[model samples]
Target: MKGLVYKGNNTVKLQEEPMPKVEAPTDAVIRMTKTTICGSDLHIQRGHVPTVPVGRILGHEGVGVIEEVGPSVKSFKKGDKVLITAISSCAACGYCRRGMNSHCHTGGWMLGNTLGGTQAEYVKVAHADSSLYALPAGVDEGALVMLSDIFPTGLECGVICSKVQPGSTVVIVGAGPVGLAALITSQLYSPSQIIVIDMDENRLSVARDLGAHHTINNASGVAEAAAAVLKLTDGIGCDSVIEAVGVPASFELCQKIIAPGGMLANVGVHGASASLHLEDLWHHNIGITMGLVDTVTVPMLLKLVAAKRLDPSKLITHRFKFADMEKAYATFGDAAKHKALKVLIEYD
Candidate 1:
């Protein structure tokens, strides 16, 4: 077996590795079908996520087929096509009982740094019954790959956390895969207006096609961008704002554009310290919430995909083979940062 190993300081290498086996009673062995490089992966590669260990098999989002099941795994059997939830959880925990699987008492993401991840030919899935979702028959790998992370992440952060509703005005900062997924999912609420902000025009165009009512290239100045958004809202602020970039500037933009009493969902993973204007947020009475997205909403997202109400495939603009994992990393990690959206690393 081969996996992409993080070599540290913005480096990745493809190396032959031993295949994974069931390590726990609740574990399952998955044959990787489609795995992907996420913006978060870039964070780890760039040394932003210092917690990630060196030589770690680096990947989280995966769609695969169950090759073997542990003794206690009951919900799935070998040969079941499944989506690996990025966040690993013990479904029996108190937090999980409250639908906060990302914060399960057991752990989230037993793979990757903590263990071997889905970047290889096979991966050990911990708490399989709770973490893996069976994919619907006939769904292609391209469409379901993101369910493991990006899609569900966006839907949870952009749609659920923001509490988007019909006739509500919303602003989403960032146009990356997760941000674009947010753009698409935000439409489900039939929001009267959806504004997408990004420095990339290509991404903003995709956001527009995905149902954003307006798009802004926040390249010049924040005040200018905020003014444009304000004008669109008839001088009022948007009802909900989603900060998807995980950067200080984008998070501040979310706060700046939010309407009084609006809800602000910070979906980005902050890699560095970010300062906030507490006085402004306090005066506006804005509600702020942030979290690692749990897989609780995956079932609903799967239904939407099955019903054809949502199409996540539009964002997968690049593909790679497992053997070409190095190239995939280089392309996604650098070259395609601006041009490509989601890059899938395929396996048998």
Candidate 2:
């Protein structure tokens, strides 16, 4: 088998690798049908995620058919079409009991991070019963691929954490895939405004088409963007500000735009330290929250996709065959140049 590998020092390579087999009673071996590179993969490739071992298979989002299941796996059988969640969870753990699957005792985000990932023809999934979702009939694979990470991630870590309320002003920093996911899901709360900010005008255009009430291009600088955000909110700032871009500048913009008593929800997987101006925030009574994705909302998201209420396909701006994954990575890694949102890597 061949898998996308992180070769350390800001590099990625496609290499031939041994096939995976069920490693535990709770595991399942999946034949990767469709996968996509994640923003975190870029973090790992750049050595931002230092814990990722060299030569690790690097992907955790995909949809596939179950090739085999361990003895303990009961909810799924061989040949079941499934959505592979990025995070693995032992449903029996204390964290899992609290719906915090991202911190499951035996398995939490092990795929592509601590273990082999879905960037190959076959990869092993731990705690299969809790981590894999059986694809609903007629469900779009491309949409399910989005469900594997960004949707639930954006909803959980962004919208839910921000405490978005009806008629509240919401500003999301970053118009990347997860940012757009938050833009899409934030509509559910009927926020009076959905403002999206980014450096890329193309992405901001996409954000507008996908329902953002306003879009700002900060290519000039943050000072300009902050002024624009304040102007949009009539100098009050936003009620909910979501930081979906992992860079410090974007996170700082999120902090700047949040109103008094507003929530700043961080969905970005930061690789560096960003300052928190606590002195300025303490007097404002603001709230801040961040976390790894738990993906507990996948089932409900599945129903929305099935009902055609949420079209995850809007985020997929490019596609490639599994053989062309290298090129796909290049395209995704340089998303701005390619004007790419999500690049779907699939098997024929």
Highest lDDT against the true fold, candidate:
2
Q: What is each predicted model's overall lDDT from 0 to 1?
A: 0.85, 0.92
In terms of lDDT, model 2 sits at 0.92
Candidate 1 displacement at residue 79 in angstroms = 1.4
Off by over 4 Å in 1: 335-338
Q: CA shift at 319, candidate 2, in angstroms?
A: 0.7
Each candidate's number of clashing pairs is 1, 0
Compare the candidates by TM-score and give the number of the best one: 2
The CA lDDT at 10 in model 2 is 86
Clashing pairs in 1: 88-109
Query: TM-score for each prediction?
Result: 0.97, 0.97
Q: Residue 220 CA error for candidate 2 (Å)? A: 2.8
Residues 1-348 of candidate 2 have per-residue lDDT tens digits of 999999998888888999999978999999999999998898898888878999899999999999999999999999899999999999998999999999998988898999999888899999999999999999779889999899998899999899999999999998899999999999988999999999888999999999998999998888899999999999989999999988899888887889999999999877789999887788988999999889999999999999999999999999899988888888998999999999999888
